[model samples]
Target: MLSTTVYKQLPVVSTTTCYQFVRLSSTLAAPQNTPLSHIPKPSKEDHHQDATFVEPKKSPFDVSTRIYTQQGIDGNDDARYLTKPTYPHPVFPTEECESVTVTHREPRTFGDKLSYNGIHIVRKLFDFVTGYADPSPANPKQYVGTRYEMTEGKWMTRCIFLESVAGVPGSVAGFIRHLHSLRMLKRDRAWIETLHDEAYNERMHLLTFIKIGKPSWFTRSIIYMGQGVFTNVFFFLYLLNPRYCHRFVGYLEEEAVRTYTHLLEELKEPGKLPNFQKMKIPTVAAQYWPELHEESSFRDLILRIRADEAKHREVNHTFANLKQKSDRNPFALKVEGLEEPQPNHGLKVMTPTGWERKDMQL
Candidate 1:
């Protein structure tokens, strides 16, 4: 059934086409000799795409965050071993974490007032942008609706953004004090070490959360802008009056404690967040915090982090109250045979607001 129209349309046939034509001609001429079963069948494909692409079930940015997966432990030859904790994380007593109350130190001074109010504004703006509202009893907008609901993704977004900025104050303060120590050729009264440690701890918090949640590019861009602006501005402000900066950080940590506390409360509710039910501790996290194991719950991780914020809140408020130049960091070392209880690294003795200079031995 060779058509003149078919030859005219192609103009010239390829070697493959000529070979196919010859085979067809021979097969027709010798149909009986070559059994009909030997001939090839022209098949029609089902749901085949010649020139089209399929969409992904999930968006690229909405996928799970990257986590560490070791091929197999080769006698402790792990890359994470190279990096050590600058300051060891204090172990939290389960009872102590349960006893953790959302506490705040009322702003007494002009600087404290400003720091307190500023944190509120920043938190309000951030909450609005990230589609997060505190579901705590204290929040005015607490309701039962999809819009009011806080998903795992939303919580992660809030934590990632909060932790990203939280580390900045400590780093800036530590860096400045370090240079000041070198320039003055005098001791920083152990302030630099504590400040650096606080910053490092906050960074560890960020790292742990990132393993659980992946932020979109839009969220990442916000982090970049926020970090840059905050670091530069905080640096300049600290130069003028370091006290205000500490106070601001103290207030900021207070908010962090409040936020995490709310998260813990939500986690207690049954059937709200199913993802967290099966969530395991990330390897990086378990390695950093010795107490954490494969079986540790996500809530356990948050408790430790909340305790950390409480510690930072205590430390920063104490720093704000003390003489930045002369006062010794009380948390760095312990004094023996003190008549009254003093501030320590762990939650053994705590001042919710902060320790006043009058009470401190130094």
Candidate 2:
């Protein structure tokens, strides 16, 4: 048994020594240094280029002259490049400045004046009923009424009411136009279509505000009653004098534009309203106007809505003027120097799963 163990140990030791010897011999045979010809050497063009050779084309600005240092630091050229170009601040118009230049000036027409007066009376009556109290009296800033007074809550409430009323004129006008078309076979199709589209668009605005404001049940009840009364009244008014109806809608939209502009300004001011930053845009608004989806804050959403109101104002005023000029000529109903309203390219009224559809059947 001892002899067999010694023999086994001798074979194991010899096998280990033989493996080590083979590895050592292989390492020694491998070349330590590569051949001079095989070794990579720097090319003449890379290290010894001609001193007088100039680039075929150079940048307009000298690269060496630019000092790329941290921004806003002394001796940093970045400040010069990074600074925004100074622009003259816009001189906005005030109530006192009657002669001030305005982008959308009030229409100079007898019908427009009459309509404006009527709207002013209605507004005064509404204010009385609603108890017109300035919310921000301590920091009073005036635009339409008082800018500082237009808190987020007040603005939202106003939008709720405004949208409810805005739908009235368009719906009334569209229905009247449709009836007239049916009565007279030779109907002005363009005007009818325009009225219907406007009504639908205004209703969309109402829907957007509903989502954002989430008004109280009391407010919703008030809107329902007010809308019912106003719709009938406007329908009769449109039947009596379509021109005047158009003019009235135009003026109403003007007020809307002014009101939204005031609200936008108030929102921009820091620390103006409580929980202002916490306000978010509604999903419905993002769907209707996808252009606002990138920065879908309350401010951006308001701006887009304001633009729609302005467009409506312009269209209604143009329609009023056209009605005055041509009693029944749709061909003559062009807004001078104004392009046709662009279609809502970003409108995706359908839900992702197609489970729901927007009430935009114009």
Candidate 3:
């Protein structure tokens, strides 16, 4: 080894050069969160090239339209239950199913008259049939539907049959004397409108299901029976409320008779008779859900549905008599919030889940 004199040269690096090196390395190793840095350094010509990647567009009406499309979107996607098929023809193939279309009426303003003890369900019926939770009691907006390709006749049928019942004839000023005794008609109207709107959405949903050929027989009967059974029991519970004591029962009876008469009159129309007597309940029930008749038959299910409605009609008549016997005005009693006496029922159906005791807390 030869020891030689070496020139000592201090190597110096420029701050700009060091910074550029660091930035170039960082640019290549892209951080996962920010993609902007991941793009490779491109030539001027490369930047001019057209990019082809695009995202798919989605429809806001997907939820509502899903029912009409055979591909159901009601939480149940099992092919066995909801068979993918084309929409079925209307139950009433001909005649005025297209007549008197339903219009979106102005929403009613809610007030004391539309209170829980007033028009809104007197008491949330906590029965076994409901499966514990009331579907959309707290948030009625969940039931809304997209207004598209709906005919005027179907709209009218839905409005008259379900929406206008309690709000129009039952609670409107000219229709009932005590409806505005407390001057809560406007408020009551609003509440009724909300209920009606919700009902409309529900009906629309069901109709959509029918249109899409998903068989809904079992659920149809269950809903009809459940509604009737619960409503009948609730009628007794309602009788105990002072508001329904005297006039309430009579009003209900009169309404029932009127409805029956109207039904008969409607039957006289050339195309209405068959629809009236042979009303398809399952088709109506499908509006509520997909899995309702997920595993049931239409022929066997319709009988129970018809029977349930009959039972409801009978109970409504009985309640009318009870209200007359009580001799109290519904509006007056409602304003006071004073409950009437409960009926003495010798027969009590013991439930497996047990009844709500006086001190029982939910």
Sorted on TM-score, highest at the top, how do the candidates line up? 1, 2, 3
Instruction: Report every candidate's CA lDDT.
Output: 0.79, 0.56, 0.30
How many clashes does the backbone of model 2 have? 1
| Candidate 2 segments whose C-alpha is farther than 4 A from its true place | 1-110, 129-148, 324-362
Q: Quick one: best TM-score, which candidate? A: 1
Please tell me which predicted candidate would have the highest lDDT against the true structure. 1
TM-score, cand. 2 = 0.57
Residue lDDT tens for model 1, 116-207: 89888998998887777766467643755755567776787889999999999999999999999899999988888899999999998988
lDDT tens per residue, model 2, 1-362:
99999999998999999999988996667444756645645556533222211121134331111111111111211222332212211122222122211134354668667888998887776555443443344644543454334445555666777888887787778777777767776655467666666677677677666554345455667788998888888878887888888778877877777677666657777887534444555445545663544245676666666666765666676556553323442322433453433222121211111111121111
**Worst 10 contiguous positions by lDDT, candidate 3:** 344-353
lDDT of 3: 0.30
* lDDT string, candidate 3, 1-362, tens digits: 13322222212345567789989997777565666656756765443221210111133321111112112222233334653323221232112221212111111223212322332252133112221222243652332353321222232232123322322222222223234324653333222332233234333434433433222233345446645654454445433542332223223223333333333334444543332233223343442333335333332222222222222233222233322322332211223332532221111211111121221111
Candidate 2: the clashing residue pairs are 141-147
TM per candidate: 0.80, 0.57, 0.23
Candidate 1 clash total?
0
